[model samples]
Target chain A: MYWEKDIETIPREKLEALQLARLKESVAKASSSVFYGDLFRKIGLDPNDITTLEDVRKIPFTTKDDLRDHWPYGFLAVPKDDLVRMHSSSGTTGRATVIFHTLNDINEWTNIVARSMYMTGMRRSDVFQNIMTYGLFTGGLGFHYGAEKVGALIIPAGSGNSKRQIQLMQDFGTTAIHIIPSYALHLSSVFEEMGVDPKSDTQLAIAFLGAEPHSEKTREKIEQFYGLKAYNSYGLSEMDGPGVAFECPYQNGMHVWEDNFILEVVDPDTLEPVADGDGGELVMTTLLREGMPILRYRTKDLTRIIPGPCECGRTHRRIERIKGRTDDMLILKGVNIFPIQIEKKLMDIPGVGTNFLIVLEREGFNDLMIVKVEVQKEFFSGDLKQLEGLRRRIVEDLKSDILITPKVELVEPGTLPKSEGKAVRVIDNREE
Target chain B: MIAYQLSIFAEDKPGRLAKVTGILKKGKINLRAITISTSDTFGVINVLVDDPEGARSILEEAGLTVSMKEVIAVVIEDRPGGLDRLVQLLLENGINVGNAYGFVLESRKKAVFVVDVGDQLEKTQRVLKEASLETLDAKALSAIEPFHYMNY
Candidate 1:
């Protein structure tokens, strides 16, 4: 019943052999690219140098800055005519990183995504509504082609427009949905507003939640609210997105497809490998990528490898859900935001005092950002409307920069907690 | 004549009220009436203090956001319809009371009604003057003695 049972249930020894073979090929393919070509040459490495899986450690880890520093095409392995598509992350931090794919690469990504979807009991007879955005973001098109490959009657219902999405679901009898966990919980209220109970009114039996890490309690709430089995989908744009790893029906953790990639968890600070089941940063190397073969790319996502084998019996190793990031980047409503961006925006506005705090909280399935700013004594004009106008300005200006509206609060100068060394500017009260 | 009241901006939390009261107590500020208006996270502490400017400066020294607003202190009868008559006058004149509080001055004979008419303070004062109603200035309000009805 497995989608790729022969490969999925392969023994560990055989899996390692497949990985070693693919890794060598990938290394040879990657040498054609400028970034890896120089790095390999600088280290005096040949494509045939790596013989065993342990030898993978000889290559240094690739960071996000490496991709950004290379800019547009430093990582492109093939010629310009061979590229079929490229997906970019938002330039929220500084520069955007692009992932290029050939037609074969797209087909491989689509197949892996389809295999992931099919393992969750999705059938060709089912109707699938994909609610993620279809543009540059990987979550949308990654699953779009996968669900299509599964032969499900698919709806490419891009993000937003909650009412129309529900109407389409009811009309088409959509049984499965691919949505972010936060949005799924928020859309439930809209369902209640329209007086439509999703459980009885429509055929929504399966959901795949990705784009952001959520608590198990939140997952259970979504599962209970939708009357469906919710699966956690983990992926990154650096490694062809959504098909990188995914949760089986067991939902214990996500099984990474080792046939396509090599996985390692290492301590972020020391950059040394941790024992299996120990929490650390995940480093990946693309084994089957033809366009851009990334070697030992540091994913920065913190998770552990589940020690024992899974009951589903897929030889692919399972990794725990992302716990946190090695950096201070925040993911709110599927957007990557840095605290420095908020600070810069605050500095540009007049009358905003020092020591602003970003308080992120999860309130009833919604991620709430409350920006607390101190009001100078001179700015208080004995009128509530004046303060309200100031607050509205902060909220509006920040929405343009971050792509989401945040609640602005005015506090006294010395009211906020002040620390000695870093002056903790952000306090995240979101529970796990 | 215009009367003054202190409106302090404060976050809604325990001990916030106590902090403001502590500052006023040290500044020897006496209050006639007090009310709080809140919206979810923060609130405004409105107090009809005898020394509005003095209380504002001292609260500012304590690092609290304090502002002074002009309010009309009306002297209404302590009877049942006394407050309603003043309210009807306000309604007839199309005036909105943004914040208000009342306290008995001489028991059944007289009481003080403190109303913050916001931008319509001048309009409300003109309406009260036309109706021949008694209004108090800053000096008169600050000089009022509320417990004069009780001799004990």
Candidate 2:
């Protein structure tokens, strides 16, 4: 059932041959791609000359902004009719970056995901519950397809509604759960509320958690509560989502699908590839993508690449868990909320007086984001004691609604500063 | 009948009360009775709120780092030594009070004492009544207005 042995075991020679073969094919494909053809011509390099993996670095790197500049379908190597699936990122504004996948691309992605699940000790008899959001986000469907690809029954559970998810775990003998680690902790608390010890629950052997950066402390908590080993799944919307690399039973670093993905750890500022085992920004080149092929896409995720063979016996190069994103996507509590979440939370609530300033401050050890909200005149008419009581009430309500604890200060209506551009919703004082 | 009392563990800090109260305020929950007893590193804030479940969830959501323990709430007269009489009665009955605090009810002529004991709650209630002391149901404390008396 195994594929080629040399490519999977003897890494150096196999990588060299794979690179030469893929480079020749990619160069020919690049010569035909409109965007890459102009890019190669502008750079004064003949794509045919780049035959080996060593020479592949001669090609330029692609970035998020580059994809944004091209917009809808500029990066696609194939026509719209051939594109079978489209996924998007949850960008700051409504406009999201789109990715297209062909039938071949889908099959390749499914293979890698299936390989990842199998490595994590998943079996065909296992019931996989994918708890990530589906929609434009790749977390849900990506995991679901991978589980089904391995002949496992999949429950497209999505995220939130912890009450229902726990109940489903009882109804269906869910053996594997895929969701963010923080949400798993939230589920642990819900498990306690239902009077069922999570540790003694229906067959949850392994959990695949991703979509945000997490600490080892958090991982220990999730493992202890669920009574199952927690594996970290790493990927970005720029890449092919959460199946990019995954922790096998060994729990070393994640085994990158090196046969399909050409990875380089580069210094962000220098743009030069760093030495192996050193931390740097990850830049990837898809060897087999058809709908949208990137030469060298800068993922901007900070982590080191371990070139050594993993204990799981996979020769695939591995990357350590992601520490943080290059951009300012802050994950607070268990929610993947942006600074915009604050504005949305404030605007959604009525009778919460205006002139608010969202200040991010670190209190003791905990990072706190306090909202200085104005107290309306109607709120004052209530009992002074009750008004003070109401103040606490509003803070509690906002915390539950947004899933982030925000300290509410009742300020005067005209105190906060007005903004011209995108409202400076976040006043970040936490040290950069 | 019965009175519900809750004991919450808290780390010692300047604004700890403000934080706990802040969570209660946000939940739109009302505390009927509250007492804070301090030790070296941590303090226990005993509270009787209108909705125990709602209050517990709010406190946990706010990340106060607290735990809940049940205590007995007994009704005593608003007069001085009213609690002393009960304490003497409990002592004669071989009952020990680990912690004790009381909150006055303005609408009634009674004050409720939240007492932590090593003995059984039912046995303690019967012992207090045998000594002619009135025992209140756990819900009685939730109906009283929470007076914000700052210790600072």
Candidate 3:
């Protein structure tokens, strides 16, 4: 249930020694990996130059586009024969990027994930229903192995079908449920409709929500409504899925699994590393990845490292809540709008349906942002004037809610295209 | 009997509804049947009251968007075809129904149809009354029951 070394309670000097030792070993392994070896040689920096954990950042940073540009098998560190299982990232715009896992790598990932679960105060006796989709994406399998590793009975309940999920929760006496925050809120609304208060009816003690950025306002609201301790977990397909770091009981921030991943904060614009307490882009170097070891991967996620020991006694470093990304994807009307921000605002509106899309277009040099939201049946009525008024109200609400004004187009339910994979939230029609 | 109908426009935020109702309460206009149809922009609340003209005055004086109309209330069978048959009568009599809404009075074993006709209001009323249909006045309609959806 814990690492061999007392990472949470270790002396500061000892922890630094462990990090340095792991950093040296990681650099040696990186030099042998064909991908890193070639890239390091091109940059004229030998892997031997990385003697300390701090020296690891002197090497060039890796990015998702790095894996994408490399394509199918370019980033593989180990031979295909050594891989026990494979997982891929759900690249929305292009072809999926794959990650290979050797048996030891899987064990390390699971142990880290199990430690994450334990850090959140979950027990081995607790039954977990992993609602994350278990397919090409690593969320399902990563949590699956980790929960089983923690010795918990897992339901393996992939996302969707809220009615069935509720039934399973009631029948199985499920103590823990893992899902994205939006879906969890949708399920809470269903629970309210069924005249069943989920907080009291079921025995859900803790809920892990991630794979997306959610605000603290929403976190508190979800916790209040569901009556469960909700913790945030951050990860990506490049870093081996959603157990990179997890929030503990204090809920101050998530504790990064330092033994596996080395965390860093860098100035988003300059790409230069920042101080501990300052907010910047998070750059992670996988210290113990086998299938695809990423060296100084530019995650583009905005958060800083929390220095000093946490009140929960976990010496593992904590990361601040993610603020925003730095990519130049879409800048409409001077508003830095991410799809996740709009989704969070929409979820807060009572009676708004699940499906929505942010349509971005350019007409005669003017940027037009339209939010195509699905209107549920209850919102429809025999009165016309009231319906017209509600239309205007929803537009104003969204404008004030997200701080970005959008033309709210109320379409019929199921009008928007639903995704079997990662839901495509933004549609930019501007010419590339 | 003549019944009055009032259409009031209010902002679609939470406390705005309470303010509108508070004005009506102070004016002592009893609201019988009311339905608030909502869209993304605004809410249109249609109300049948004991004193529509008075309600209109009170709402307008309070700077609310208000309108008064002469709507005919016809009592018909509560079952399905009762409304279809009445619509046939209006069409057969050359009365064009512009906008309409209905509600069932379960205790009275009847459904009340509120109709806004196109320039044939008198003829529509005469034809319905001749067919032994009872018309409800604003006072009687408003005294029946208060609207709950608009408030809660």
Chain B, TM-score, each prediction?
0.93, 0.79, 0.76
lDDT of 1 by residue, A2-117 (tens): 88889889999999999999999999999999999999999999989999999999998998889989877999899978999998765444466788999998999998899899
Docking class of 1: acceptable
Writing each residue's lDDT as its tens digit, candidate 1 over B5-99 gives 88888777788899989998888999878888766566778888888888888998888888888889898989999999999999998999977
Predicted model with the maximum DockQ: 1
**Candidates sorted by DockQ, best first:** 1, 3, 2
Give model 2's TM-score versus the native structure.
Answer: 0.62
Q: RMSD per prediction, one decimal?
A: 5.4, 14.9, 13.5
- Per-prediction fnat: 0.36, 0.00, 0.14
Whole-model lDDT values for every prediction: 0.87, 0.72, 0.75
The residue-by-residue lDDT of candidate 2 on A44-154, one tens digit each, is 889767866878788888887778777887788877898899887663343356888889888888877887887788878999998888776778878888898888989
Best candidate, lDDT: 1
**Taking the candidates in order, what DockQ does each have?**
0.34, 0.02, 0.08
Candidate 3, A111-214: lDDT as tens digits: 88888888787778999999877876788889999999888899998977888999899999899988877677678777887787777899998999887567
